[model samples]
Target: MPTPALAIVPLSRDDLPVDTVELARFMIGKYLVHDTPDGRTSGRVVETEAYPPGDAASHAFKGRRPHNGSMYLARGHAYVRLTYGLSYMLNMSAEAVDVGAGILFRAIEPLEGLPLMEARRPGVGLRDLARGPGRLTMALGIGQSFDGRDLCAGQGLWIGAIETAPMPVGVTTRIGLSRETDRPLRFFMPDSAFVSGPRKLLESF
Candidate 1:
C-alpha cells in the first residue's frame, strides 16, 4: 500500500530568505516535492549547506558562467548541477536577481512515493534513499533540466511546508570542502535520522 499523502502547502518566493545562510537554515523542515510522470516523490528537507556570495567553495565564487547562471536568478529558483562528474546536486538560488549564491540541499527524509524512490535507488534502505545530495536528486528524478526553474511556482518541483512546526535545527561546518571548511554553514534537524554526514556533527545536537 502507498504511504498516505501529507499535507504540503506550497511556499512562495516571499517565504524564502534573501540571505544565503539564513535561507540554508530556513530550508530545514520544509518539503521538497517533485511531480513526475512516474509519480509524486516528496520529502522533508533534512540537511543543507550555504554557499554564500564570494565563498570559495561556491561554483559562483569566480563569477557566473553559462553553466552556473541559474545561481544568479532571484531567490526560490533551482540551481541543479552535476558534481564530481558523477551525480547531480540540487540547490536553491539564495540571493536577489543577478547575484550568485545558493543553498545546497544535502538530504531529505522520504515521505511520499516510497516505492518510486526505492525503484530509482534499487536495494537502498528507506533512510538511505535521499541521505546525500546526489542521492536526493536521483531519488526525486531531478536533473540538469530542473536548473533555473522557479520553485515558488508550486508546480512540478517546489518547496512546501506542513502545519507542524520544525524541530530545533543544529549547526555544523560543511562537509567535503577544501576551502571555507571551518564555516558553520551547514544546518540540519538534529533529531531526524534522514540527515547525512559524519556522526561527529550529530554530536553537536
Candidate 2:
C-alpha cells in the first residue's frame, strides 16, 4: 500500500532563526520534505550540528569561495555539498548573506515515503534510513544540484513543520571532527532511535 502523505506547513525565511547555533537547535523536531517525480519523502529532523561563523571546522571559516558561496547566502537556503567523495551532506544556510554559517542536518525520523527511501538504501533498517548526514541526503534524494536553492521556496526539496509538540532535546559535541571537537554544537532528540552516532553519545546527551 502507498503511504499516506503527511500535512506540513512550509517554513519561510522569517521562520528560520538568524543565528547559526540557534538555527541548528531550532531544526530539531522540524520536518524535511522532498517532492520528486517518483514520490514525496518526508522526515522529522532529530539531529543537527551547527557550524557557526568563524568556526575553524566550518567550510566558510576561511571566507567565501566559488564552491562554498552558497553558504554565504541568507538564512533558509540550501547549501548541499559532497563529503568523502562518496556521500552528499545537506545543510541550511544560516546568518545573513556574506556571512558564512550553516546547520548540518545530521539525522531524521522517517515519516513518509518509506518505499522510496528503502529503494535508495536497500537493506537499511527503517531506524537507519536517514540516520546520518550522508544517509539523510541519500535517502531524501538531495544532491549538489540543490545547493544555493532557497529552502523557504516551498517546492522541491524544503523544510517544513507540522503541529506536533516538540520533543526532549539533547546536546553533545560534534562527531568525526578533528578541530573544535570540544564545542557542544550538536543537538538531537534524546528519545529518538532514528538519531545516529555512538550509543554513548546518544545515551549521555
Candidate 3:
C-alpha cells in the first residue's frame, strides 16, 4: 500500500491578517506541526498571546535586530528564541510588512505523534509534557534548530488544519513578563485541564 499523506496546507503570508487578537483566537485548537530534520511531531494549540508592534512588552517593540529581525521579515515565518538560556519558545510572525508583531505560543495540548514527544522529553509526566511554553517547545523538538524556519510552507515545522472545538471561556492579562507591565493581552482556554499554568480571571480586553 502507498504511504498515506497528511492533509497539510501551506499557509501563506497573505493568509494571516494584521489583527493580532483574532489571529491568537483563531490559532487556538489548530495543530502546530513540527517537522524537524530528525522527524515529525505535532500538538494542539491550547493557549496563545498576541503582541503588537508598538507594545512595550513586545520583543520587537523598539526595533529589529539580528535576533528578532525575523519578526519584521514578513508574516508566516517562525520567530523562535531561547528563553533564560534554558528552553525554546515558538512564535508566528504577524502584522503587515514593516510592522513588527507576532503571536507567542504559550502552551499546547499534545495530540498526534505524542509517543515521539514523550521520547523527546523523557521523565516528564504526560499531563505536564507540553504544558508550559518552553516545555512544549522541548516536547515537540523545537529549539534553535528550528529558528527562522518557515512554518507556512510546511517545509519545516508548520501549522496544520484540524477540526477546532468551541473555545473555552478565557481571560486577558499582561502576559508573564516584567516589561510593558500593564497590557492585558494574554488569552487562554479557561478551566482546561491542559493549561500550562494557573488561570487568571480579568475583566475587559
The candidate maximizing TM-score is 1
Clashing pairs in 1: none
lDDT of each: 0.91, 0.90, 0.74
lDDT of 2 by residue, 1-205 (tens): 3454777999999998889998998888999999888889999999999999999999999998888999999999899889989999998899998899999999999989999999999999999899999999999999899999998999899889888765667888899999999998999888799988853453332
TM-score of 1: 0.95
Badly placed stretches (over 4 Å) of model 1 are 1-4, 201-205
Best by lDDT: 1
Flag the better candidate by lDDT, 1 or 3. Answer: 1
Candidate 1 global CA lDDT score: 0.91
TM-score for each predicted model, relative to the true structure: 0.95, 0.94, 0.86
Please write out the lDDT profile of model 1 over residues 1-205, one tens digit for every residue: 3433788999999988899999999999999998876678999999999999999999999998999999999999999999989999999999999999999999999989989999999999999999999999999999999998999998899999987854788889999999998899999888889989864453243
